[model samples]
Target: MHTSHAHTLEAARYAALAREDHAAGELRPLPNYALSAISACCRAQMAADVPDTTADLIAVLDSYKSPEELLREAEQKARSEQEYEEQQRAATDMDAPNRAKRYRDVGTATQVIPQLGWSRQMVQAVEYADDGRLWLDSNGTARLINRAGVPGRVVASSRIRLLRQAGYLRSENDSEAHLLVTPEARRALYLADLHPEGIHRDDRAAHAARLKVALTRRRGKQNARNEAARLPRMDVWAMRHADDLPATLTQQREVIEEQRRTEEEKATEKVCTDSIEEFAGRIADHLDDGWALNFEQNPYYLDVRYLYLVHTDGRKLRVKGENCGRDEQGAALPAEKLKVWAILPDTDRPIRSDE
Candidate 1:
């Protein structure tokens, strides 16, 4: 007898279901006649003719194997599939991070802007700013000119204004003349290999040089204004002590010298006071031997004062001092009789009198 392909396929499917039932322990202790029918069904699958009905197909499957045999086969097949999956997962875990990093490093504005539906020219214009901001004129023209003295791509103004409306860029000031790139825009530009001001994304030296030049210019302007303000004060001082201006300028010299000395003395005193108190408290809580303040001395003039600390093993450290004296009102008192000194732990040498 011959069977059609569909009938053969159907018989195989019924056999598979019976096998699952056995594996699940729902079918057991198969009868001999059923086992024989199942075997006959398996053989029929190789031939053209096989069972035409589902019942006949299932009856044939029952003849081939007992429930216990079917269950064992199912379990073995499942174990093999699980092992294959675990191997695939382990391989993926090892390669995932490096793959992700490579993906991130390859991003460029040309590639990213297209994804956001923005034109390449817009990104180019934004990248022209050395400071991540673009300034425009009343006519919506960019205020900055390139090295060749040509106007920038002000035609992209419409696109920039649209982007600002969409929240990708923001007005830097009230004039609506300047736009700053928002973080989102900067990130997109970074991914696209488009850096502002023609600067290389990773060129730290070039970036620092530009920053230094800007700061120096600002400082120079500030200094000029300060010198202008001080000119009248200088004239008045010179008039008050014409003789002293040529000889020693003793009063002016003393005022400047005292101001400098007082600042140094206060700083030294603060460091010594904080270290011996606050730092020592935290250290004591953590160490078994701990630390203790040994002694502190106040100086009247020109000699070093001391803050001493003792460790568990009897080692002593002289930590800090102050030289300038202050009256009750915190005014700078005469320093003619006061002395200050300290022995630093790192060098174990007394601080110089002049220092």
Candidate 2:
């Protein structure tokens, strides 16, 4: 009749049902029953009345999740259990083609990789395995490591699946442990000391093939070294002249150089043919502050006869502007370089801020 004891019995009954259904291979309804059982457990701990209430128990039970949350958590646990069971089954399945070839000592599974065409990553994976398994060292830079070994190249985790697809990891893997390589790959890459097991060759021919692979690898490496040694010393005979290189490359160089010369030539001519404004502007630097300039030109020659220095507080000064010479700071500049406004030849104008 007690609510907590009654709910506890209910929980036990539901749990028993779940376990029985799971044993009978009828798992679909287990999470629903599991959720019900957990709800009962939660209610069992809630204070039914003050007499039965303990503050800690009541507070803890108050923290119980809503029904929907409890259901989701049960479903998630079920999924995890299902996955774990599947992995366990796979681990025990001795007849799987991938695992059955585990102990092979020799013979290529198939001609999957091309001759000398193994990528550096693939070769390193095979080369740096520990025992028969490649393990990870948990580090940012030290990825794809072999235990206690020098750091291996950072191969992507996805590359493990590729090795499985290739024949190198063609055997010797536990269900989810894809890093365990086959004996043949281990012997060829690491040990070179395997007498075959149940899967493949068990003789002199296997050892000879392994040696032949090693020899081929060395010869290829030597050939690469020879070519590398010759590379810097050798020059391309076709690229000896501008025309000998590709026309587009020659044109690119010519285009940039031509742009440089075009601007440079204008700058060179600028020294001789400066605008009259630019020539007159220089005189301001030599003039004291508050003093401005104006000019009137000769009728036929490129020269001014009347040039005035006007002060802001109403004062005017005149310098004889005909054929005058100046220093680098525009001191006493000649009249020819200072006059351009012939339209106002008779009028003297103040050089305001707008000028």
Q: Which number leads on lDDT?
A: 1
Find the candidate with the highest TM-score and give its number: 1
**Candidates' TM-scores?**
0.28, 0.17
lDDT of 1 by residue, 258-282 (tens): 9979865764553233323443344
lDDT of 2: 0.47
- Report the lDDT tens digits of candidate 2 across residue range 1-355: 4987898899899989999999999978876677777777776877354243335543454456578876897899999988876684466443333233333312231222222123345446665454444554443222444466544556565444445554455433343232555543543342122221211232233233434554566667556544322211111321122122112334556889998777655543322223344544655655677778765443443332345567788777654332323435646544444433321222454333123
lDDT (Cα atoms) of all candidates against the true structure: 0.48, 0.47
Candidate 1: 10-residue stretch with minimal lDDT: 230-239
